[model samples]
Target: MDKTTTAAPSAAALAAGRRAGWLRELRETFTLAWPLVIAQVAQNALITTDVIMMGWLGPKQLAAGTLASTFIMPFLVGAVGLISAIAPLVAQARGARNIRAVRRIVRQGFWATIILSALLIPLILQVKPIFLFLGQNPETTMLAEQYIQIGVAMFIPGLAVVVLRSMLSAFNTTRIILVLTLAAVVVNAIGDYLLMFGVFGLPRLELRGAAIATVVTNLFMFVVFLAYVLNHKRFRRFHILWNFWKPDWHHLAQIFRIGTPIGMTVLAEVGLFTAAALLMGLIGTNEIAAHAIAMQSASMAFMVPLGLGVACTVRVGYAYGRGDDEGVRKAGWTALGLSTAFMTVSCITFILGAPLIVTIFLDPDRAANTDALRLGASYLVVAGLFQLVDGAQVVAAHALRGLSDTKVPMLVAIVSYWFIGLPIAYVMGFTFNLQGVGIWLGLAAGLAFAAIVLVIRFAMRERLGLLRRTL
Candidate 1:
């Protein structure tokens, strides 16, 4: 007897299965991402708090602090990327249950952080001469130098926090990292109040107070995180403390090979923004202050997508380690979706609240700040327009990094920012007289370009099943 022919599954069934997969991926990514997002915001609080307190001092201080930070941030961010070599390694190790590899990666992360921090000191010391050579206002440049000098004191500890966070993020131990960063925030805020205003009879250090507060907060975070990682029973199995100082040249070299590109990519993006800030300095102090205010707000919003990117790296890295190509695709795409959704909301918020948001960093009642307030509000509009594209590119880049495909993304960033973005910024700001708005438009276009290219790259890599390829 012939059996009844079975019907193939309908399109509706296939669509339903796809929807279920997306829902499952989104839920998993959200679980991994939210705590990480909070941790990032809290960590940024260390800087945001400094900027806010500096704002209270007056416009000149704000401008000076902003300029100094622009120069120093590239170095700090690049160092973080160098240390980021730990994330994928630790994630993959955990996935494979290779405790020994995890320990070795952590130890080498420490070594990398030290080497990078030492290399940054000479650059930090020359800030005064460099800014002077750039024709910055002598008073403003000197103030900037003062702040950066104090800030350099915290580099090692700050990088230690980064390395420790990378490892914890891979293990999805973000909640603990969140708690520690929050404590650092509180300490930083209280310290800023005490030192900046001379509250409780402490010296009124003004901008220097902001720098000192940041340094203290860095130390607090590093010590607490180190203690937990070393003593906590959950980390005990890895024996991270045993031979912690042991030198491992091969692994360290491997880290640099993987890390240098990541570091350069970060520098490329940060350098563009920092270059914009410096260009604003040439326009006038008012413009510089306004740019700082608008950029600060944009940066706060950016932490959400930035954290999602980190989560994507860990999730995709874990899946890669396990040889789960499908898992890698799901993790990357879910992260992209989440970042897009969040940036949409943020963009809308920035547009609607431009006036109110810019005022937060300035003293609204002060007539002296009227120009800065007006200029800052307008700049926020530009900031709002770019949020979606900015989020897309950053998340896409991180997704590729997770798949160990950073070299191409680095090239994409260089071309997008240097060859395209900065040239437009210069032409518009000067030749076309768009000023600050023109510079910001260039940033938006560059991010859009990078986003399109990097997203396509990730798609192709997935299709080709190259997610397992490491540097």
Candidate 2:
């Protein structure tokens, strides 16, 4: 054979192999992200399911459901952050081929979650009355109390499920979370249909029924998650605390050592949105209602970026474990680029279809809506600008966490949400009289600042061997 002619086949083969590898990576990323994405969507659907079921019992039930849900957010998100300490830890352990450490991490997470859940129930119970005193109507206050009692009463089962789900995600078994989420959604929806409306021999319980459905579904899922995690190859070695697994003060210290700042990080950022929603309530139910509509739309766009953020943490943690500087850089860039591209398209769609999006939450007679149609449209329009920055900030924060440099980004959030975001929203909305859109615009500024600083910090950490130093 002629030398050049013979070499041509090898070149072609190499190119084909490269293409295949790229395709495989893309596939793996999609597969891993798909479960998380669906889980998030269904989780949102579960909330919407409550709202939809309550819509039948008149405005009071709907209003009560939304109001009570706000008090539940701190525990949910903060606990998720605390559980998230397992992901990077598991990823690094997986990369190092240390299955035992990963198992220990997950089991410890579950045991610790139980203690935290116990602590949280009373905090919410005591403060429930305080929220009621924050100038609510008589009817709304009564409904809010009922919803809170049912929901918080069910917090333990719900809390166990999330912590276990996080453990599954840590070992790259997101499929279990997706399955559980789907099961939970379907069961909850049916329970809402039956119990809320008194179908299928169930009594007409309405909002309380929705809460009970959630609790029952969560309980069912906790069992399923337990079964799957035990069967998982990565987790099979560790016993599931058949004996006493009391709170290891030292391990709890370690968890909170890593987890507390991250928990505060979640609390600060989500707290901003929750507080903004409450402030919107001050302006009018119209404003609060419109804000909810816009938020649902934004959350859809958020899923892609959110999935990217998860992937970033996994890749960053793995690269950091291997001590591969170049791999770490490539992983971060790839995650950011992919996330930004997908999210930018989603944002554009949201901007263009804001009204159509809002209409889902309304009817022609508009029974579910209390606001003008134009309000949600206006909110989504301004909200579009923030998607890019929001995507940037979240992905950056995830990457930083992957590198185990979580504190700086947490600090960035503190400044962005409190110092810059909330103050600006208050000034722009009430002070300047712009209201809902003004508040979102204020949030956009916070996201922009968070995005810029986190990206800068990521670069600094990568160059300075911050991951190496931390590990």
Candidate 3:
């Protein structure tokens, strides 16, 4: 009887097979996540360096820079979300071994980037009137306008880098991304110093100088990454740029269809934070400066989970393309677990080291910094409180993206952040007089809500019919 058909594998054997599968998946996820994590941290380092230098220029300039950033980030991050559609799309094509599809998706990603940049640049350039209308301090608004005028030039190249980086991430060629970003950090620092200080005979442009440096760094990154993608032997075979001027309206529309919700989702969340910043602006210059420092600290820690979330999208997209339900489950859960664990560590660190972290951005010895430093430390503790939920929400949202499930998540974000989060922030900070900390508490509440809902949706993917492929 063919040796009894080798007997159905014992329960123990099946258990061992599962254990091995989990271990293999964990390894793969870690490999993919580490480079992305480092790259993200390095990218943030570029921003942090600017913040530190801004602080050196004094609290007033720091506040101005923060105001400018709050305005710029919503548009920039939302556009990055749009360009990031290339990742899941390319990963799925790769999973199906469809080379032409990969090229088309990437080419269209570039198209989306260019189009978005054109629309956004004009809007961002009008920040002066917008901020003035919003009742921002006239002085800070003027300074912010000065900074943004030059910085907005980075918009196109910055979005282009997102498209290229998304393509590279899907292909698991992230080490080069890491190296390039790290180099940019150094380049940006040097540029910031020379131009901001007028060192080495360079003219001092101050805040405008910082903006120029950032634009140069972004342009450098885009040019180098594009060249690498076009010439690298591994990627050249796809001929992503071969058509140059041809349009793929189908894939272009597909990118917008999938990406618009993602951009809106990011905008909703970033908008909430921007609203909070505006609230802080209403409070005082010290509050705004403190909020900026605390936000930068939280954003720095957030990079790890964000990187893991991105990796999850690629892994889950690949599994979904192969129609391997179990693979998708493993990839998603493993990434969730890893992100949660890292965030737990970050939470503890923030709670215990808030003072130290605050001091990094503002000098405790400087009496001028006293109020901002104290407020920053307190805000950081609240940031710690929300860290876990923030990590969980990001990973869950990204996992859903792997399944091409974004529209519902966009609604979730709008409801959670705008409907639930912002009102609480306003009422608590102003009506209840809890001040800045209350605003932060509201942010925590929103993230916790998003975390719970999105995780539940992902957990019930099969039941909710979210795993069905629309593409």
Q: Kindly report the root-mean-square deviation of model 2 from the true structure over all alpha carbons.
A: 3.5
- For 115-142, candidate 2 gives per-residue lDDT tens digits of 7888888887654576657765566667
Better of 2 and 3 by lDDT: 3
Tens digits of per-residue lDDT for model 1, 386-454: 999899898988888777777888899999998999999999889999999898888888888999999
TM-score of each: 0.96, 0.90, 0.98
Sorted by TM-score (best first), the order is 3, 1, 2
Off by over 4 Å in 1: 1-17, 463-465, 469-471
- Residue-level lDDT of model 3, residues 310-390, one tens digit each, is 999999999988788999999999999999999999999999999999999988999999999999999999999999999
Q: Model 3 clash pairs? A: none
Error of 1 at 306 (Å): 0.5
Worst 10 residues of 2 by lDDT: 242-251
Q: Which stretches of candidate 3 lie over 4 Å from their true place?
A: 1-9
